[model samples]
Target: MDRPKPCDLVLTLSLSRGRYGVRFAQDPAEVLAAQSLRHRAFFSRTGQSNASALDVDAFDSTARHVIIFDLASADLVACYRVQFLEGAEIAQAYSAQFYDLTALADFPGILMELGRFCLHPEHHDPDILRLAWAAMAHLVDQAGVSLLFGCSSFLGADPLRHAAAIGHLSARIAPPDRLARAKTADRVALNAFAGMGTAAEAMAGTPALLRTYLGMGAWVSDHAVVDRTMDTVHVLTGVEIAKIPPARAKALRQIVTDCLGYNNTVSAMH
Candidate 1:
């Protein structure tokens, strides 16, 4: 299989009528900024506070870090890392460490795994999420990525609190039985969450990123693995690029187009 070429995803979106831009992390300091945000977003709720804390792991070296910056103030607001792989390289994927991906071993197409997705704890502007997806769309189109998969995390490690939201995914968007079986000993079957929570409560409790995945016709694994280290529960989520809804694809592409136009205009000025 051929490897993907270097991505040229440059998004400078006018989010919330404010300046926010997306680009690959250019240096160690920028990568550290992304790690620092992940540490805050992932640990603050657990009462952990270390100003020097960073969420670093072996995967950092292999993945391309995507960072979103508030251009107006030069603050790094959101970040996620993507690793491109062919089915032959599946074992190297970060998500492979948590879930059983044997079902996808013969996928026969380019796959992208998005991990460590987080936003600044204090920055809650919804448009940041939109821009994130738009950025992913840009890369997906450029790389000819057939599948986008990742661990879509719920904030806490306990399953009960997220039962309803988990149930909603289990009941409505579970992946085919052949995919992503539980590999972790601490996994909770989706059946445990089945019929557990109200639809309203479920939607309210579901993480925004997972909700975005569902909206784009993504599906989740049959169980969630508990990660006490991160204090979260997450299920393997996958979106077949070809299966994304037509209207949703159009909307995402429009954002990508707008950002590309902005990037080109800026390039000409330079």
Candidate 2:
């Protein structure tokens, strides 16, 4: 998984709602297309230096990329990178660049490293996002993913405005096991930062994606770290597939079923 390569998109589902569709990156051209969209949604806005007009990265080759496009505009609207982790070689995943993940070494089965989740700035409505999420649920079920993890971020690399959001997460959400605790790096104690002895309700300040993860029983790192290159402060986040929230799980399963006619062998995840 360390070499320069192209990724495979296993399957794609188009929404019956008619405005969007989700597909796996099937070829280099599609990968480049998604990269260009990433540049527009991320690098271009951050003013960071890039190797090309497209936001290309080494992980593009090994990860399964989910691409969401607007049918009317025939343009990419959102995308996510999911890397399949095998054995104890998680350092090969993108989350490793932000946190010391030696604690997750013993995690069993397939661990999906979710990253570079992007949504075009203009298309931030809930409907399109639903399709994207449905696609993610399908991926989780299809891959038989046991664990889902990645870096959850806040804009501008500042911890001030987001003190409440990240703080609340750290205070309320603990991973299923401490085995996944960080081995290094500085982290913020959200409750301490927000001066809250318990979880603070700062849903307004939290990113939609992070909120979704939290609602699905995901947990975050102890503190946030500033990523100068990405111009954001981020915390490592993880979700156990079996532990996804019941209501949210039903919605996700409905999405997969309605959009792709997916069977229930995937169970609530379908």
Candidate 3:
């Protein structure tokens, strides 16, 4: 699929110093290497982890993998797997294990699942995040994806600490149509944090990640789930690209463009 056009000048300036590039894995070795980097970032392991390094589930074979390499260092810095659900591939999507498929039965257009997102710990430069989003925009444009959905996770199993943040999210952002309404499995429940409000002051201490999503017009599900494998609690979040706020969308596009130029070459040392 054709990628999105490069971002504007400001975004270019932000990522210009680094040799960064993103591409779909064309071979098994690249896929494995992407997996290895995921293992390192997600499990705190080097090279590979016997207990958790091989985190591939039923989704690996069907999903398209995007890997970012630091050309100067020749190291994989970021990666994500995207699964398109439509036509022949619809029956094999991976998120079915966590979400109820019945809720999505009436959606009229194509849907894509963004999952297994991970980045190397040392490469947490904000520019990398921008580049990843740029790549995502490119992918969405190419696939003609109308809606993007996935489970955005918090770092630990505790939802109490994040209650104020989650409550703030629930009160502000509205979920998609009924088909996309958030529902938790029986194992998890939505925790209510009393006195939470939508005021900026009330949400001042929310996690940056959730804040980012809210800024992008994303809506949270009704409840949260405990993901034993990742040892975290997560809420379902979905965004309709066309419905994204105009100003924020423009800002995202600009940021992504700036980061692309920086990612044009990879670092040899990562």
Candidate 4:
């Protein structure tokens, strides 16, 4: 697969729902807005409140940033970054930094690595989450992305704090042995807590974003990386597009189709 330009992976499209709009970052300011939101969401507890409190890394330059904003206030409410990769390009993915995903490097299909997904500390509207998924669905279809992978984070650096949630992933959606390996020096084996909690307790403890992935038949790595720099424990998660349930896929596509139709109709009227 030849390398595509950064612009090629981004679609010239914008989606709106209620008072929020979703669009790919078009300039540094927009991308910085996303970084700012991520900083607040991820680093508030660490007191990184200097003027340069933006959460940024090398991957930011190579990936596309998706920003969800309030139409009325023009405030970025939620954001995430995605990097498109062919099987051969798996090593360049953000998740690759923490997990040994060499197994997926030979997998046949395009993959998208989603990272730094977060909502504004003050924005709690459920529609924000819905809009995020809708935008992702559109991107997946447009790019022909066959799989989606990322590190789903838990709030603390301690795995025991999220034992039930990690255990649930271990018991229900642990990836096959061929997918990922525990490469991070600071990592906890998920299976150690697989039987520590009940399914109900597990679901309650799981993060919302991860729960959404699991609902779509996603799976996770065998261990969780204890990222002390970020003060979070995370497991590599992957969702094979083909393995998603038919009903769930339909619902996601319906969101994309409806958003497109609504936007087109509104455009035509003007």
Local accuracy of candidate 4 as per-residue lDDT tens digits, 91-162: 888888898888898766678889999998888987788789989999888888899989999998888999
**Stretches > 4 Å off in candidate 2:** 1-16, 47-52, 173-176, 179-192, 196-201, 261-270
* Candidate 1 to truth, TM: 0.90
Residue 113 accuracy (lDDT) in model 3: 77
Itemize residue pairs with steric clashes in candidate 2: 5-61, 167-190, 188-223
TM-scores, all models, native as reference: 0.90, 0.83, 0.78, 0.92
Where does model 4 exceed 4 Å of error? 1-7, 50-52, 173-177, 261-270
lDDT of 1 by residue, 124-240 (tens): 887677678778988888777898999999988999989999887876555465378777899888877788878999999999888888998988898899999999999899898
1-270 in candidate 2: lDDT tens per residue? Answer: 653221332444344335666767667777887787788777666666354678777888777777777655657778888887755678787888766777787777677888888888778766678777887787778767788888888887677767767667765555555334554354555556755333435777788888888888887777677776677878888888888878888988997777765221210101
Name the runs in model 1 displaced over 4 angstroms.
Answer: 1-17, 172-178, 263-270
Q: lDDT of model 4 at residue 211?
A: 90
Q: Write the per-residue lDDT of candidate 3 for residues 1-270, one digit (tens) a residue.
A: 653321110111113324566667767877887787777766663223553355666678867788777665667788888876653343355655666545555555667778778888777776567667777776666566777877777666667666666666556534445333333443344446545644674476465556677777877666677676776677777777888899977887776666654535443232
User: Cα deviation in Å at residue 197, candidate 3?
Assistant: 9.2
Q: Count the backbone clashes (under 3 Å) in each candidate.
A: 0, 3, 22, 0
What candidate 3 gets wrong by more than 4 Å, as runs, is 1-17, 45-52, 87-91, 172-176, 179-188, 194-209, 256-270
RMSD of 1: 3.7
Name the lDDT value of residue 88 in candidate 2. Answer: 68
Strongest candidate by TM-score: 4
Q: Higher-lDDT candidate among 2 and 4?
A: 4
lDDT score, candidate 4, position 77: 89
Q: Candidate 1, which ten residues in sequence have the lowest lDDT sum? A: 261-270
- Location of the lowest summed lDDT over 10 successive residues in candidate 2: 261-270
